[model samples]
Target chain A: MTETRGEPDVEAWAESGGRERAAWIGWVTFAARLGLAGVLFWAGWTKFTEPVVLQRQAVDAYQILPEALVGPVGVGLPVLEMVLALLLVVGFATRLTAVISGVLMALFIAGIASAWARGLAIDCGCFGGGGPVAEGETKYLQEIVRDVGFLALAVWITVFAPGRLAVDRKLGL
Target chain B: MGKASRERSARERIAEQRKLEARRDKQVKTLAVAGGALALIAVAVGVVVMADAGKDEPAYTGPLAPTSRQDDGSVVMAKEGVTAPVLEVYEDFQCPACKGLEESSGNTIKQLAAEGKVKVVYRPFRLFGQDPLKGNSERAANAALCAPGDNWIKFHDRLFAEQPKEGKVGFENADLISWAADYGVSGAAFESCVNNGEKGAQVQAMTDHAFNTAGVQSTPTIVLNGKNVTDQAWSGDDLAKAVQEAS
Candidate 1:
């Protein structure tokens, strides 16, 4: 006696292409986010363990935003990085997390670029002790450019993917 | 069944479907927003931590006479000079870890030097002895030998301070010259030594001697009181103890 749109038209819903497109985008986003998160998490952990070394390098490069903000940033960055990394791996808030990651990567690239431009011969301090350089050397432009590319990928994830396999999707959002 | 009854049933079914869809949508949106907020907060925390890290700059409070050359290439000593145990270290200009040791432990060494507990004499060794032209090690060594009176220590410090981490060649002549100028060394003299390879043979002989006679196999090999302690893992304290014992 009642018409119910024939089980919500499963074939039609699947054929609209949104689901397929989202799947593809979601997978790509997952890979990129996971990769970036892992790298940042490693780097952040190293720095957190050796805050003194990182702080010294940062000051040497003159990358600190302001003289006053240095101490707090050093202490808080590692915990933050670990949390974000866990979120990304778990596919929690994938799009938003990707965007944040992209922004952070962009900031890092900018910092490296500025240091290179200024000829501050110091390590990037992205990773902890005994970096690619022995010490007292600036990161090259090539490394910064590579980061820019990664940042672009992250931004792509933010725009196209909606974290299909994430908690959001599980919640039916 | 009556037509009205059928119509009423259809309306009820439609309402139930709409309600379910609305609930699902709400759940998804909430999850998305909440997860996103958590990630953003993590990023925010990371940025803040990095920012705060810049505050604890290591201070060089050692009692070394802060020596810097004036514009006219005159050496100026900040504190009264003292007699100390002597330790001569021969190093290459382009060696990366040399730079690290210098930045990390240079002040501590200087403090020891200033206190008359130790004296550090840096002998330059050219690791890139194969390429005589662009070899930073040879050029730096030559410059130091040519202008030892004015630029030896300062030039030594600057070289480690500005050495490139890794590359095809070492610092260019221009960079070396500028660095020499920073220490009040005569740029012309530094350039000429670098160009002519003034201390090429001496540096080679010293490096060879270090290997053959002193068994020094590393850039940071330390000579404690004329005895080559190359094999031992020598720290500042170790050197201090050796010096005290020798004295």
Candidate 2:
């Protein structure tokens, strides 16, 4: 599969297909990262705007964890989410960013699941306040299921594709 | 040596290598920039959307100080110790927000009740009356009423804690029995009361009183010191201030 003159080896290149495959994967990575970043950014923004609601959620979570850690975790989660969203969107250390997003989604799923299991009728507060959990309605299971799907997509991008057309690669980092 | 031919070959090779390197670099840079830009846009959009969504939510402007009936069929208001304030709460057991109010403010109200500063009255309304088999408001009210002595508060809290959200499906007879066991109440007594529709009339009367007499329109319509506190922003601090003023 040798090419004439300086042209790349078409047949060998076709067999390896590293560049072409990367390009295709890049598009997938781009779309997934964008979608997930949007979701995280929105969630973090909600927490930031309504600190009280976030505090309530944190306190509810506190019931499941050590009291000492609740305040710090509550305050840190939104900020951390913002940073992760930025990282994912900007293509800064893409694989690392995707992993962080995946982990956060997993944690969110766990939190909702635990709250449901404990029979706590509180809002998930993934997006800030609406109303408390109404009798006979458990939104947690659905929420967890959604997060699982997002996590799967994130993991796929993290492992197989470089964040398509990101600044990190542009900066040669 | 064929100096001319060798020179041309060397130049060509160098030029080809440089072009290949440049192409690779350009592709990499383009990919990186595009990815980064997309992420940033997503984050920005997310932030705006989330903020808007938060704003669209309705603020909780319902009752501040909630009151409930004790097992002895006596009205227990938190203002007894807090002041001469009268607190009335119209609640539905199946309502999730009512449950939140119960969990969050139950202790504070209990303290006020013990102090005998506030007069609290609880009116139970059946919001989920549409569901006959699953709605637990009537049963919960009956169970609390049938509880022995001062076990009403304990039972009330337990009901809120165990109550499921709408659509999640609540406990059946067996589950309720287990929950009663946790509260040290005899399952048989609780079950009998629930099954026999005990306190059903009382619950109905109270709900009717709230709507017709008290002009209550919501599950948690609180009256502070005889003045209706419904539709007012009732935070913990606000409640304390109202108590101080009434005192």
Report how far off residue B158 is in candidate 1 (Å): 3.5
Candidate 1 TM-score, C-alpha based? 0.51
- Alpha-carbon shift of residue B89 in model 2 (angstroms): 3.0
Runs in model 2 deviating more than 4 A are A1-35, A45-83, A89-91, A103-171, B1-74, B78-84, B94-99, B113-117, B130-133, B146-151, B161-195, B208-247
**Could you give the DockQ of candidate 1?**
0.22
Candidate 2 chain B lDDT trough over 10 residues, lowest sum: B55-64
Q: What TM-score does the predicted chain A of each candidate obtain versus native chain A?
A: 0.75, 0.80
Writing each residue's lDDT as its tens digit, candidate 1 over B1-247 gives: 9999999999999999999989887877867577567757756776665554553325456555554433322233333454345566656766554554565455656666666666556655655434422365666666656564533566767777766533345566667777777767665666788767776677767667666876766666667678875323123444556767755
Residue A82 of model 1 has an lDDT of: 70
lDDT of each: 0.60, 0.62
* lDDT of model 2, residue B80: 27
